[model samples]
Target: MSLLETLAGKGLRREPPTRDEALALLATSDDDLLDVVAAAGRVRRHWFGRRVKLNYLVNLKSGLCPEDCTYCSQRLGSKADILTYTWLKPGEAADAAAAGMAAGAKRVCLVASGRGPTDRDVRRVADTIAAIKERGDVEICACLGLLRDGQGERLRDAGAHAYNHNLNTSEAQYGDICTTHDFGDRADTVRRSRDAGLSPCSGLIAGMGETDGDLVDVAFALRELDVDSVPVNFLIPFEGTPLAGQWALTPQRCLRILAMVRFVCPDVEVRLSGGREIHLRSLQPLALHIVNSIFLGDYLTSEGQAGQADLDMIADAGFEVEGADVPTLPEHRREAAPARDAAPLADAVPVPDAAPVSGARADLVAVRRRGAGTELPPNA
Candidate 1:
């Protein structure tokens, strides 16, 4: 049998490929790589077809993190000039969800920084989620740091459908990136969220100086955990962050990583998360072949491709955005577009009763939530 067929046949049950084997695939010529990617694309098509799931992030809080995670601009003792603020009022978060819905996003993520949420934080987020749900349709995914024992239940009750706590990297390489907490802590949160009945959305960051073995380990770990959604982020080096100016990743390398993850975890929602523009750039269109979803609009502490541009890209690639198949603006808000340069940065204080405060960093810090209601940090 052909190598591609053999690889596809083994599927997720296939033994993890060795570093040399992965490198051999990575080293394939562009023509050969495309052929491999084409095979992988079939797997993607079989499950997701031409429909693209677009997610928008609402950084409900920004900056003021206590953890010393090396890669974050919001970590303690860092000098990155980002905005910081507290949680948004419930009304505002809901309005943001409406904006996301108007922008054609299938899901709107509510992300916060710091060490989980206190009971108070949970209630506040829960209320916001309830309000968002009242409006209808858009899926709500909450990222409130490390989840507490019952906080996931509270969120589920509040109408949150998913929880996002990225593993960031493989277990073996996690320590090198952040010393404040162990990889197990992140895993536990996912488990807790699952037990609470919320869909567990977890993922990793590539190009953080990890080995192919490390990548394989992370891919298998996600598969073992049965993650409902996997967001594969490429590290976007920020000034004052530990990994700032570390390494540059090529588009082909990024595609290979995406293809590898798709081959390993065939059924999961392999999303193209942060760093798609800078690393993938012109090649972003091709990534959709292997990845079933992507983040629409902006990301935490970073600008992303404009919503209209994303719509154009989807059409150009022969794929359809979830809500708008023909590429035209929605009927109700044809003239209304998300402000081109209006990404908001707000400080995210932990909701009380979330997770224990590890010496590292709080789950989230200074980040931005697009839509309505802007909560600026003390200095901002």
Candidate 2:
């Protein structure tokens, strides 16, 4: 068997590749790329098998971020125009969860923008989490900026099954993306979430101008941190962000990154996060050969492949979405009827606490002109 196959068979942690070895794999030929993915698929099938976990993300608070993350559309210093809003009330959050469940999502993620969650923010999120859980059958994940003391525990008590705080990039490359926070701080949050009995979901962004060495470092870091879930994001450049024009990803490169993550973190729930449609495009089903999970519905501040299209892609690829039997609301919860609005930028607002997100959060707003360049059909 080849080195890649051996690694996949033995499991990720058992014979993890060295940096040099990982580089060699990155330089692999296109003909071998599918083989690499197939090998990783064997490992994935061994653990998960055609079981694709679909997650839905609700941007509880739209823009209003305090940090200056270079890759985000909602960072403090961004010039890209994006929406601005505060935290939604508990009822509104719950309603979104119900919609997600109806849409066949196994979990609903509550994401807010800011440097970190304050005491009030945590309490409110916890309450909303409780309400969502009470509605039944869906897992809850929180992606607030950072975790404060005891906040992870409170989230768990309130029925949060997982907490997502992505490291975004390698330690060396992290400072280049966001100076407001350190890589260590992100690691600490993941550790605290794990300690608090919440499954930690973390991952990195590929095509962020990082080196192959940087990617290897991130994979190793995720393994070292014992993260339960890893999200591999491709950088989707926005016109007003610092890295606005930096779109260096092709489908092959994206597939390689997913395969690499699977090789390094075999048992973890490797997810295909943002930029999949833009970067992977028609090859999205191939991504499932490596990643066992995906973000369904929508992403924060960006458009994703349509839900039905994603389902079609998965079926076409010979895989099935997990938890298709889960019940969900027929229509998504919305604050108001859909209307035309300019897309919101990353640095638009400086973290405002809106209102309880439960029943009062407005209907899901569609950012006009945001989906223009991507391959996804309009209105998806």
Candidate 3:
């Protein structure tokens, strides 16, 4: 049987892909890339049909992180001038979350940047969680760095439906990305979240100068962790971060990575996160075939296509948003919406070289224009 056939069969059998099989999927030639996506699509449709889940991110707290994660603009000793802030008031968080909920997001991701949440931080977030839950049926997923002992349970009590702690990369490559913490620290958090009755939502970031083996390691690790949601972020390579100049992702490679994650963790919700616009460019629609979930609007530090554009993309691609029917594109959106990157440079969010993001918290109102011209070859 062809590899695709075997993979499709494995999906039907609810069997996970082996290490060799996953590597082969990643190694798929550029010419045969669409074929792999098609096979992964088959698996996706079998489990999720043409329904896409819309997720929205509420950056409850931004920047000022103590950890030194190389890819994160929020990390310590970083020069990216992204917004920094202390915790938002519960009402503010609820309001931010309401924007996403109104946009047809079925789940809202509440993210804060820090090494871990203290008891006070957890309680503060828990209050926000409770307020958001009180507002509607949206699922609450908290991405507040690491959780202290019992903090997950407290979050559960506060109405957090899921917990997000991305493994970021493989155990072997963990040190390259951030040395303040290790891979085991992340894994243990996933376990803690799962143990506390929050659905474990973990994932990885591709194109961070890791080997193919590192990608495979994370895919299999997610399976072992049995996470409910997997977000595959293509590294943004923000201009001021340590990885700033590392623009090694292509749309095809990004798709292949999503397909591999699907094959390895067939049933989980694989989301195309972060660098989709800068990296995926025109091919974003093709990704819907392999991933069931996506962030609806702006990402934590970067901007995404407007929510309407995302809804239109899902509808145009013949997929329905999870909680709402496919919306009809008005005449303006009917012809492709303007590429987010085409926006003027002044509109782009700049990760400034500064102290804690806390300094720029008030500048959140300064919207970055999503412009074009950032793509470079993997070697560039």
lDDT of 3 by residue, 1-380 (tens): 29888988897666988889889888888899889989999999887888888787888887788899998877888777566777788888877766666566778898888888989998899789778866665677899988788888888777777799999899999998899999999999999988887778999999899988999999999999988789999887776688877878889889999999999988778898888877898899999999999987788877776666777788889987765433222232223222221111111111122112221223334422232224444521
Q: What's the TM-score of each model vs. the native? A: 0.82, 0.85, 0.86
Top lDDT model: 3
Residue 101, model 1: lDDT of 58
Q: Give the distance in Å from residue 164's predicted Cα in candidate 2 to where it truly belongs.
A: 0.8
List candidate 2 stretches off by more than 4 Å.
12-14, 324-363, 366-380
Backbone steric clashes in candidate 3, count: 13
**Residue range 160-202, candidate 2, lDDT tens digits:** 7779999888898888988898999999999988888777889
Better of 1 and 2 by lDDT: 2
lDDT (tens digit, per residue) of candidate 1 on 314-362? 7789987654332211232223222222122121221122112221111
Candidate 1 has what TM-score? 0.82
- Name the regions of candidate 1 deviating beyond 4 angstroms: 11-24, 27-31, 323-380
